[model samples]
Target: MSLFTEAFMTALLVGAIAAGIPLLLAGLGEQLSEKAGVLNIGIEGMMLSGAYFGFLIAWKTDSALLGFLGGIGGGMIVAALMALLCVRLGLNQIVIGIALTLGAEGATALLHHVQFSQSYPRLSAPMVFSIPGLSQIPVLGTAFFSREPIVYLSLALVGVFAYLYRRTYWGIALQAAGDKPAALDSAGVNVMLIRSGAVLLTGGLVGLGGAFMAIVGAGIFVPFMTSGQGFIGIVLAMLARGQPIWVLGGAILFGACLSLTTALQVAGVDIPTDVIQMLPFAAVMLVLVFLGRKANLPSALGAAYVRGAR
Candidate 1:
């Protein structure tokens, strides 16, 4: 390929990978939660919360790692609350989730005000380094080996999750809980504990995705920084039919949509930015409407499991 072609391909790949990171992280997290019969609608709010909290902590402590941790911590806390509302109180999952999202958003906005007063410093990370010997290759090198530590970490988690969900005992238990909770409960499995763990995992992963945005993508936190990645993730989780491998594929498709929108603007397309931006959501709506009736969710999904009760 010519130098120009090579460079363009490299750029497109980089953008797609960057866009895919958040979706992959968030979708995988949701996959875990949904498989355990929990539907978390607060992912969007949790992501936003993480971005603000993580950015502020990193800025104050001057530690990118700490900021990332803070993001996970923030997300987990919210998840815990959701668990209490849904699992402990036996409240409606959808209603509790919507409430949690609203509460998380208000809390994040208030916290942002208190931290910045008016303006906050951008949360920055150290320069991403190329791996030794491996980063010297052509397109793949730039796409993978030259990225930040977190990017690699994200990809590694994908493989790890795929393995666990497909190969491990815990994975089987989780699926059983979603498919036939009564049988699993009779077998002495703790259904509530399984559900709780799923929620916490979802929160942490989504939060990490948000931290990536503030620290690496923009190097700053603004209100609603996560945009709609969390909601997109929920759609992706459904589209993937609770399979980790398909989540990766679906995320890439969405990432391609994202990349195309930006690439069009950069190439001086005559369409309005809003028009391009709407494509993803429009597609999401179309797909959901078309597939909603056909999609077969877990038999126990959206129904709280009641032990010793048929």
Candidate 2:
């Protein structure tokens, strides 16, 4: 059997898309939070919480849709706390974010041990939707056109977010909240409300990403399964420079590297698995090193906003 068969290459592309979706969602979510002046370092926690609850719900109920919703709720639960402490009460964002991640790690680990340590289970394969004409194309058809519905929805969100940033009043307000909260407050806009809303939406998107990881990407949930994807998402968002399209491009790039790593392993490359696993991170960092100097972050990101403080 030839290693570089058409089937093998097609599978690699599919794997890339699967791996990229979580990063895309997380990056998009991080972009929204940054736009609202919140540096969400706890995004890892949100994704982990989403994975746990999403998988639990899906396993118990056998419905992927409800699992995804549960995942969203799980992420939002953490985000609400972030908003309350960091946005509403003006706590230290970095400290609170790290604490949240630690809390989530411990809590999910305990829950998984209690529930599934003895009998680890996995879900059935998720349903895939193949486009009529597009699915008929050569290798690209199966690679791009035939995927779970969430894949399509995640891709569409790129366009939706781009529109929100470019052609909407809310976008301007988000920019104001991040760039100049005092000015936005002076204009009678509820800066806190906008920021809080962005945080919550961030959680939802990140949670959905977690759900995709568990329900579709891996078909199972493990504690600490996010494994720094959230942090990578942050890098993607920062390097995107407020462009959703750029986030998409970065996510795809990372995903392609991941796929390449797997392909190398399958082709019997004599490399350490650990070294092979480093490919994606190394590739992303190389991009960062080259382009990060030009990345334009929000001026007020990570700064707490007080209503009237000068």
Evaluated with TM-score, which candidate comes out highest?
A: 2
Residue-pair clashes per prediction, in order, are: 0, 0
C-alpha TM-score for every candidate: 0.90, 0.95
Worst 10 residues of 1 by lDDT: 1-10
lDDT of 1 by residue, 1-310 (tens): 2423655556656777888888888898888888888877888877877777778777889988888898888788888888788876668988988887788778877877787757767655546879989888897799889988888888888788888888998988889878898888888889988888888888899888887777777788877677779988888888888778888887777776777655554444566767766777788788778766555577888777776666
- Show where candidate 1 strays beyond 4 Å: 1-4, 265-270, 281-293
Report the lDDT tens digits of candidate 2 across residue range 79-136: 9999999999999899999999899989999999999998889999889999999999
Alpha-carbon deviation at 82 in model 1, angstroms:
1.0
Alpha carbon deviation, residue 34, candidate 2 (Å): 0.4
Best model per lDDT = 2
Question: What is model 2's C-alpha RMSD?
Answer: 1.8
What lDDT score is found at residue 156 in candidate 2? Answer: 99
lDDT of model 1 at position 293: 57
